[model samples]
Target: MTEPERLRADAVRNRAAILRATEELLAHHHPQQISMEQVAAAAGVGKGTVFHRFGSRHGLMRALMQERAQDLQTAITGGPPPLGEGAPPRARLLAFLGAMVELVARNKGLLAALGPAPVATAPEQEPREEHPVYRAWHGHLSRLIHQQRPDLDDDMLAHVLLATVHSEPILNALEHGAADRLERTLRDLVSGLMPEG
Candidate 1:
């Protein structure tokens, strides 16, 4: 290959190596404890290569989060049953929440190892009405509820149902040995949210 082409290939390899090392390290050690030298060594590349790939530690962390978010979006949109499609709206809603709780549990471990970094709260970026996941979940649930019971306020009901199933609090309870109680409470919550006889 030409010299420039070879150099480009090498850079690609180095970037991949650094990202892999960052993910592995982030899984087990806090980000503050991680250093460019450690990532370079782990990636089997020179320290300078790590810097070239990511300008700083925060940049690397952002890259990691972006990658994780992409992976999660893909899984939720393409993976099995409830997550993808092929279940009743009510059942799928429950399943989606359960799966999300499990995912948060796993991610919490990795995030903890990455240390407590402040997350930017973006209230303005809430999913739009047409976003596929939002539409698929809320629209489908609303349809199902309306089909079975036309009297309920579908929009408000769907929001309340989903809001209660958020994963962070669920993960906290699970970590605190309150998983069984949480499960019972979730069931009660779900039942209460549904249209009454």
Candidate 2:
């Protein structure tokens, strides 16, 4: 391959390594405590490389979130069935919520770190509404709600539903091994919103 091609391959590998290292660190350490230097050391890359690639801690967290949520995004866009394209609106909505439950459960630490802070928060923090993953999920949910009940305010309702899954209550349930109950509650909530005829 050409020198440029080799350099591109190296960059890709380095990116993957950095994300993997960040994920591992998030599993054991709070997001606030995991510095760029730590991530660089863990990934076997230079601190400058990490900074150059991600720009800042927030950028790195966002990149990690995108990487983690890529599979769900692909499935939603193109995969089959309720989580994908072929189901009814209510079914699809429920499936999406269920999938999000699992995703949030698995990545609670990272999600908490990336979650929106209060209005008075620092400027560097990204709000949940502005995050790319949140936007995609909100858009999907809003579309599904519109399909089911055009009379409702789908945009606001979408935010409400997303909030249900991302809230402290859901996180606490997952921590307490009450995921089954949590899923049931979510199913009930969605069903209530889009009741069958």
Candidate 3:
């Protein structure tokens, strides 16, 4: 490859290395505690490389979230029965909630590390609806609810359901040793809302 091509290839490799390091750290450490310097060291690159690629710690987290969200979106859109398609509306809704719980749980660790980001007087204060991952999730759940129970207020129900799976609430439950209980409760909540035969 030419010099220019080799340089471009190195950039790609560096970007991948940074993301991989961030992901591994996210699994075991809170986002706030894991600094850009640590990530650079873990990735075996200079700190400049990390800053050049991600810009900031928040940027890095956003990239990690998008990566995770893409995988989840793929599963929900075309992977298989229940989450994707080819199931009854009620069944699909249940499966969707189940899958959502797992997704939230995986990301909840990050929040556990964050510890009450942007604290609000009300429980519903945290709203990240504009993020692509969040927007896609909200749209999918809202659409599913509308399809099954047209009479109900779909927008309101969708917001509330998604709220249940948000990072703060999930992390709180996990902290209290109630993660399983929370999942079961979410299942029950969604199950109750499903339209009857």
- Provide backbone clash counts, one per model: 0, 0, 0
- Please list all clashing residue pairs in model 2, or write none if there are none: none
**In model 3, what is the error at residue 50, expressed in angstroms?**
0.9
Q: What is the per-residue lDDT of model 3 for residues 82-169, given as tens digits with 9 covering 90 to 100?
A: 8888887777777877776666566765544433431111234345666556678778888888888888898888778777755565
Candidate 2 ranges with C-alpha deviation above 4 Å = 115-127
What TM-score against the true fold does each predicted structure earn? 0.59, 0.84, 0.82
The count of backbone overlaps in candidate 3 is 0
- For model 2, residues 51-149, the per-residue Cα lDDT tens digits are 999999878887887776878999999999889999999999889888877776777677667664211122565666886777888899999999999
Worst 10 residues of 3 by lDDT: 114-123
TM-score of 3: 0.82
Which of 1 and 2 is the better model by TM-score? 2
How much lDDT does candidate 3 score? 0.73
How accurate locally is residue 191 in candidate 2, as Cα lDDT from 0 to 100?
80
Maximum-lDDT candidate: 2
Q: Tell me the spans in candidate 3 whose CA falls farther than 4 Å from its real position.
A: 1-8, 113-127, 167-170
Model 1 poorest 10 in a row by lDDT: 113-122
Model 1: lDDT to the true structure: 0.61
Per-residue lDDT of candidate 1, residues 1-197 (tens digit): 99999999999888878888988887788677888899989999989877877787766765665455455456556777765566655565556555544444445544443332212112454333443444555665566567545788877776665454344565556557664566556556655665334
